[model samples]
Target chain A: MKEGTSISVSKLTKRFGHFTAVDAISFDVKEGEIFGFLGANGAGKTTAMRMLCGLSMPTSGEATVAGYDLYKQSEKIKKSIGYMSQKFSLYEDLTIKENNRFYGGIYGLSDKQINEKTEFMLHHLHLEDQANTLVKELPLGWKQKLSFSVSMIHDPKIVFLDEPTGGVDPLTRREFWTMIYEAAHRGTTVFVTTHYMDEAEYCDRVSIMVDGKIEALDTPSALTRQFKVQGMADVFVQLARKAKRSDN
Target chain B: MESIQVDHVDKSFQSGKSPVEALKNITFNVKQGELFGLIGPDGAGKTTLFRILTTLMLADKGDAWVDGYHVVKDYEQIRKRVGYMPGRFSLYQDLTVEENLSFFATLFNTTLEENYELVKDIYVQIEPFKKRRAGALSGGMKQKLALSCALIHRPSVLFLDEPTTGVDAVSRQEFWQLLRGLQKQGITILVSTPYMDEASLCDRVALMQNGSIMKIDSPGGIISQFQKPLWAVQGDNMYQLMHDLRHDSRVDTCYPFGQYHHVTFNESTIDIESLKKEFQQKGVHSITIDRTEPTIEDCFMELMNQ
Candidate 1:
């Protein structure tokens, strides 16, 4: 494992009855780094992320996240990290500030801290104008942005962003990534999973999981150069094509 | 005459507390047999405009014309002339692919045999799954089925709103190919997508944001108008390179594109050799510098900032 890594796994496997969703995957996520977990739809990326976030139990193996043991120290891990899934996971009926308060309360933040954090998120996301608007009333992109900010209301050391920028415009996606980079620079490690190969290339290091295995793990340039490809899309294509060949 | 025109169109919703403006004076036109695109983020009035043109919804103020038929006054004619595939897959899930095609054909008082040639190329792929439920098929299949259904009526104009959002890359490529094939048949297409790369596939695109057109032109024409010198810079320390370039006065905008960071410099005062020296000074080696062209994303970003 890398020194002072925030996440580590060894022989980590997750299965549901006959189907294995995560199969003996081992990787380390360094502190204050942006680690990308890439996979197509239904490629076990979500399953693996669930295991790491202590939301789901692994069928077997050892894993540590945010320096908490995956098996016994799940609560500590949960408290130390933030998670945002494909679903907004925010209350649609509640106003933007109310949703943040709800999430902040569940994460066990003090009322005062929640208020400060709520204000910061609202200001940072330019949501001050829409703070009182119901989340459902807001457009899809703003809802996504607010949900992402809500994920970190409790001030977690690490954040898990799962396709956070899906279906957003390029300008919004760009601004969102800028916020992610800012978070990383402030000593927070970002563990994100996305289907967008181009977004994956922006991560410091990315791992492509296919059929419950980390088929490739390297920096975007390193992987692309090693695979004799031009971009992350080509690298993923080549790897995915190879898997189909093996299956055939 | 404009092949398609929306004259001062406006739409509003009763928000209980107050009125909300969904669209405001949204005026634009597309030429006949010209592939036009409505490029915008979700809920940016692109769908509102499309719905108005397709005769699904009405505009509160002004009117739209498809193939010279007024949208509000000549609703039936507008419907007959425009093929619309909504952003969401609204096909009949229970029906088979062939049944869905026939149903849409019947909507326009037409038959499958009357427009079989119009949809044959797309229908052939799903022909094997003619009996399979539309819901049981894959995303690509579902999209193909939807497209075939839309074209079954032989509309002179087509409209697709963010059609490739959830589909895979391969499916997106194939969907565009099908659209291109249809476009060559002398049908005008107005497609919208948040994906900037797909912007190039359209003959002309109107970059819409916040219920307004930012820029409208051919994809190449728009990209060529990007006002900066871009370079793809890479080195051992990418993380640091990105961080450093963001604060560099010489670097106007630096975005991580694939393996390298695409950096743009102020066109009036760009010093490439000095920038290379600065990169070297930061312990960044293996720095390869080259003039990079602006992509649709860059163009959209520029347009948005403007």
Candidate 2:
């Protein structure tokens, strides 16, 4: 394992019965680096992400996350990573404070630590007075922002965000990226997946998956230049349009 | 005559004790055979407005008409003339693709054979999976089935709610092309999406936020209304560049856009050479700055701030 690499994978593969969901893929993410994992729907991104997060086992691969072995230390890897998805993360029925405490408990934090962190998070989000308010009562943007904050309650070494700004407004989407940049600035590795090509440009480095393979991996500018495209959107379309697999 | 007309529509939902306003004085009109868009984020009253126009729900204190029929008084007439595809996949999961299409055709007192020409372009893509259950089909295939069902009735006006939401870029482009084909057939299309980029695809768009309409104009019209001189700035260190630009006195608003930081100056014009030299003095090197045109998103943010 490299000294500064947060995640290192060599020829990772996952197969489902007769289908090779994720073909041999290799990549490395450095500490505090913003890595964009991009692909079209049904491009094996979710399958590959599941294996990296320790939620699923890879059929064939050598990988380490946060200095822990992918095969031997899957349990430890889970504790050292934070994850949030646009579809589900925070409990809508729970109050903001309660949700924080619940997640903190799940991460095995002590009650005292949970209390302190919850207060800090509430203060940062400017929801100190509304801590008791139900998450469903808050606006969509606030809920998404709060969800990102709570995902970091344990202050894990790496955070995985799945389309975190899917349907957010333009202004709030920019704000969410700022939050992401701040997290990376604090030396936490950020591994994010998004459909918005514009968001892909914000990544320090990006890897595009096509039909279960890492078709392209480079900085946004390099990828654009290599593809002879104008922006990340065109680069994405050129690669994704040739995909043989149907959309999932 | 307008294909769709909405006049001061308002709707509120009971969250707990107090009612949360979902739509506030929303007014817009879609011309005949025009492709109009309702562009906004989630919870921006788009679905509420769609429901009212489709005659599935009523507004609290306003009127709307679809296909020249009053939404309230002529709801039955409106329902018969409009084809609505809700955001969520409303088809039966257990039903096969073919079955769902036929079911929808039956609801409108029509048959697939009768309207084959109307949906041939979209239906043929999903024909190979006709025997497969709708739930078993892929996202793109499922969307095709839903669109086919919506067009089965061959209604004069089509209402699609966030049809491209969560869809990938390639599929979204294909879907829009299908819509263009429908428009050529003289169908008035009204669609909603959260993607600001998609606004440019429409003939005109109504930007909505916080239960209110911000502006209604052609995409080009909105861009022209943006009177600020914008610039795209990039440097080796993006985070530091953003920090330095935000703190600059002459810079108005700076936000991270795709590959560069989009900046608006308080003054109308900026000295490019001086700005580069000034950044060098601040120790921000490898600076690349150029004047850029305002996109729909830039216009959207400007209107939102106002």
Candidate 3:
């Protein structure tokens, strides 16, 4: 793995009216590393990802992604990063190749680049035979893989995956991580958020979020060691239990 | 009496130009006090089979019996005698957890007091939020509520379709423990999960794919059929090990499981000494190879390949 630019976030906050979805939180993601963003439902993982991907503005903070400013250079930040949202962001009715074309064009990729990228992605996903198949007809795993590839159409420096393998089978989740590993090995910084404890183990580092702040953040092994747990799954439960107690 | 019995069942759904055969001659029997699992990914016909077995739908071919009664001939009796928890949260969102449980109990012409002992362990967990709307609860809480309602009627058989999907790991473990408790009370459970690790929790499992039974056996039995000597290998250079093993002629199948790659040789006669030598020759310095057992995932992959 290659060393990536140090992402610096100082007291990042995102508020929607009275609800502070992502309350003053900060964490750095190094280059060429898989960082797991973990949280329960509505634990602000999505809100934080939205801010990092430059899709939403932070209420107050100084942050940079891939060395670009998160505020004034938001547009540049978007170009330097890829984001696969929870929802299927691709065109449902479009053909497999057509969705790729649509995403590439939207990312300002030229015709030649789009053509090469589509061909490469299709072959890489072993979906060359199904390029003409409508996206609606594909299985959940194929659609997820294809969607991830499309998000990287512009060759973003960092890729943000929000539950990219969610709703798929465990087998597909394994295959999906292989692709994630491939991306990281190729010097693409992988920033992902998932509730699956096993998926967190696949990452080099993980941050467990509770309430609106990160309760624990470190290498998966370190977290497991500090929490005195045998696995990440148990570690997550311990944190969740703490949160539940506080709420009570 | 057999809890559930499916004999030579087949299901097909018409898609525009052709029909999709979901299940092919599927046959299995769940014992009176066993926790059976239909383990596979989505579109593996788990839901369809469960629906037919629970008397929610009729199979196009073959017949199934619940509690020794034909599914078609005794549909009403089956419904009364079996508890079905669908994959989705089908409970009334507007009703409180207590209300939901009582409603389900009422459906069976029984009161909560009559079946309180059956679901006491699960119901106690949700009793604190008895007045909370079903939809307002957390994922884990909602799951417990669903199971409580399903058991409130004291059904002889329980069918939970992917009940633990989208839930936290701890919740999943807890739910399985609850199932085991019910099994001890002479309740037969048929649970479907896409998770391979949970396969071992079942008394017996049937691995399904594209509507066909790939294999049906105990988890240990299925893993033993791997027919290859497996090894858990880890080294300084995982990338190199993965690449080398994938292309290695002696390696039948290699997959990254957690921190190590579970590799297997095409022929069991190949000794670990020789396999280590081959890896060392491939520049995998300081490799650790130890005999490892195959996982349900490996077994499923092998079955799917064939």
Off by over 4 Å in 1: A1-3, A9-26, A54-64, A67-78, A119-143, A210-213, A241-248, B1-3, B16-18, B96-99, B109-114, B127-132, B235-243, B249-251, B279-289
Ranking by lDDT: 2, 3, 1
Interface RMSD per candidate (angstroms): 4.2, 1.1, 3.4
True contacts kept of each: 0.39, 0.84, 0.21
Chain A TM-scores, per candidate, are 0.94, 0.98, 0.93
Candidate 1 interface RMSD, angstroms, 1 decimal = 4.2
Per-residue CA lDDT of model 2 for A17-120, tens digit only, reads 98888999999999999999999889999999999999999999899999999899999999999999978578889999899889999999999999999899
**Candidates by DockQ, descending order:** 2, 3, 1
Give the better candidate number (1 or 3) by TM-score.
3
- In angstroms, give how far residue B289 of model 1 lies from its true place: 4.2
What's the TM-score of every candidate structure? Answer: 0.86, 0.98, 0.90
Higher-DockQ candidate of 2 and 3: 2
lDDT of 1 by residue, A154-241 (tens): 7788899988877687767866887888888888889998766778888989998777788999988799889997788877766664
- 1 versus 3: better DockQ goes to: 3
lDDT of 1 by residue, B1-306 (tens): 468998888999786577778788888889988888887777678888888888888889987888898887899888777888988889999998878887888888999889888899988988988998988886667777888888888888889888887554545666788888888998888998877788899989988887777888899899888887778888777778888899887678888776678887766666767877888898887777787888888888777777
Runs in model 3 lying further than 4 Å from the true structure: A1-3, A13-24, A39-44, A55-62, A71-76, A85-89, A167-171, A195-198, A210-215, A221-231, A234-241, A245-248, B269-284
- Indicate whether candidate 2 or candidate 3 has the larger TM-score: 2
